[model samples]
Target: MHIEVAKKSLQKNNQEVYNFLIDIKNFEILMPENIDKFEVLDANTFKFALSGMPEIILRLKEQHPYEKIVLGAASDKLPFTLTVNIIATSENESEVGLSFEGEFNAMMAMMIKSPITNFMETLSKNMDKIA
Candidate 1:
């Protein structure tokens, strides 16, 4: 099975959001329970640990500060690609639209979708605070 999620977040300062993306390490502080570890391996590469799982490798396939960021992940349990696009609507406004696509067995797919959706909602809600 495959799953996808798209969310629109309230706009905020573009530079602030861009800086937030660059400071990858701060993910743990923003979403402590869901994100175990976020390491910037290089300018466009990193490794991360998700909830209840081992560290997964992720490479920033594409990134445009304050505009968009796309990440790909490969895992036995769920091999998926997540694309996050951030667009600045105004100096103090921006929106983040996330698109997820991938494959998984039916049972696992059903189990994972709910949590993933919840996670996205929570993340979007907290963007203002973090920004």
Candidate 2:
């Protein structure tokens, strides 16, 4: 399944957003309020846990300068990819979009579709504040 979240216009330029995201620690600023634990393993890896969810680790898979950042779960158990794309709408502004890609069975997809969509929307909406 693939989900496209809302696109947000950021006050920061594409390079600013790219610089912030390339550093894993900055991700904490966009985390949910009920985080249980957070850890930065390195520049490219970080792990966090929500109130009742298991800790999930994410790693920077690939980054294309100021254009996009590709990330994926560090563990094979959680097979998913997240791509953050930045479009420079103007010299001082940028449009940000996030896409989540995962393979899920029918039952699982049905169960998670709504929540994941909401999460993605919230995440994209929140990025501007942190950028």
True-vs-predicted CA distance for residue 76, candidate 1, Å: 7.4
Off by over 4 Å in 2: none
TM-score of 2: 0.92
lDDT of 1 by residue, 1-131 (tens): 33445555565666677677666554545454667777877765677777786777766666687777677774445577767677778777778766667787778778778776765566566665664
Candidate 1 wrong stretches, greater than 4 Å: 1-11, 32-51, 74-77
* Best model number under TM-score: 2
Among all windows of ten consecutive residues in candidate 2, which has the lowest summed lDDT?
A: 122-131
Model 1: pairs clashing at backbone N, Cα or C within 3 Å:
11-94, 12-93, 12-94
Candidate 1 matches the true fold with a TM-score of 0.70
